[model samples]
Target: MNYTQNEKIKQVDEKTLVVGVDIAKETHYARTFDNRGIEYGKVIKFNSTREGFESFEKQIKEIAEIIGREKIIIGIELTGHYWYTLANYVNKKEMMLVQVNPYHVKRAKELECTK
Candidate 1:
């Protein structure tokens, strides 16, 4: 299932909620965004433990309900082994998880800052 950039972009629509997470060894930070890149809530800081994942899931569900979006796509930077736990948790929860390139994320941040 290979997707071109355009196809990948098309996957997000008005009914979709995108979650971008910055994974760390112990804690993770997440933000919710709409298909047009508008943020919906504050940054969520959750630990890497199961309790933390549960908290994260709760927040995501609340946000989605508030925003009236049913589809969730969680994206995380593909770092070290720290992301494995989160990936598995997201999979078990039956949500779509996207692994992003760390370098690409860094470069995008740099470009954003220069704007």
Candidate 2:
């Protein structure tokens, strides 16, 4: 099965900043949200590497400035033993890491659909 990078982020618009990422062996999908939870941009593909870190740094800086906050919260579905690298990167900065259950995300989607 094949999946597009943008398919990972659901219900994006221009509100409270949120990013949905699908962790993969090679690359990941990223979607962004604004202060009001509205997505106002494109979903781009990001790889896990040195250059990837550079790009992520630039984006994170922009996000921090937008919200006037030094810290950001990043959530990823816990993939047991494989996402340590990504977790480390977030932990090294003035940011927080959240573990989300895929089940919960699905439930939320269901609720949103009913709304």
Best by lDDT: 1
Backbone collision count in every prediction?
Answer: 0, 13
Candidate 2: regions farther than 4 A off: 1-16, 64-71, 111-115
C-alpha RMSD of candidate 2: 9.4
lDDT of 2 at 97: 63
Clashing pairs in 1: none
Tens digit of per-residue lDDT, candidate 1, span 15-103: 99999999999999999999999999999999999999999999999999999998999999987889999999999999999978889
Candidate 2, residues 19-68: lDDT per residue as tens digits? 66667776866666554656535665777776775677678568657755
Q: Which structure among the candidates has the greatest TM-score?
A: 1
Candidate 2 global CA lDDT score: 0.63
